[model samples]
Target: MIVGGQLVDEPSATSPGTFVSVDNGVPLSATNPAGSGDWTGWSITRSLIDGLPALFARNAATGALY
Candidate 1:
């Protein structure tokens, strides 16, 4: 897999990534399903990781927050 534009050498290893967004006070509603919520589009500017293999965080000190 690829992370940070570099190839991950460990076949049994894992990588983590995140998605972020900012609230603009705009409401996004689903009419058919009757859903309502504000749309906070993904904040790419604040994303630390992007376009990487699927993973999750578990600890802060170790950079994992699962």
Candidate 2:
């Protein structure tokens, strides 16, 4: 899981090195799935949006939530 814009492993996450978006706010073009190619993220820093800290990304292929 990518929490707070930093990759983190969930307590019961069965798969490793996998990530998905917990919220549906992320756009379709913003994602880079791991299996699609590799090296999905870079300079993934957290930024403020509408005076709120928000960071969103995901692999639409997974269709699973952690």
Candidate 3:
């Protein structure tokens, strides 16, 4: 579980989860799963500086943008 964009781990198994903010400290997406194995669905995005073009990539698992 995420809270504020940083990974967190606890010992008692009752502590809150961690958060991960994306896009330069911007909140992009969030997820809360019941079980774990291979959390799929993600995407990616490339940005341009001045005149260059940006490229965006998406995957089949998490649908996350990078």
Best-fitting candidate, measured by TM-score?
A: 2
The digit string of per-residue lDDT tens for model 3 on 1-66 reads: 122532223233244553333332433334323233222343334588797977554545555444
lDDT of 1 by residue, 1-66 (tens): 223322223322143552222222222331211122211221112233576554432222233232
**Can you give the lDDT of residue 61 in candidate 2?**
52
* Candidate 3 residue runs with Cα over 4 Å from true position: 1-24, 30-40, 47-55, 61-66
Query: What is the RMSD of candidate 1?
Result: 16.1
User: CA lDDT, every prediction?
Assistant: 0.26, 0.43, 0.40
Whose lDDT is higher: candidate 1's or candidate 3's? 3
When superposed on Cα atoms, how far off is each prediction in RMSD? 16.1, 12.8, 12.5
Task: Tell me the lDDT of model 3 at 14.
Answer: 42
Error of 3 at 36 (Å): 19
Instruction: Please report the TM-score between candidate 2 and the true structure.
Output: 0.25
Question: 46, model 3: CA deviation in Å?
Answer: 1.1
Q: What are the per-residue Cα lDDT tens digits for candidate 2 across 2-66?
A: 43434443343357844443453333333343435432443333569999986644444554221
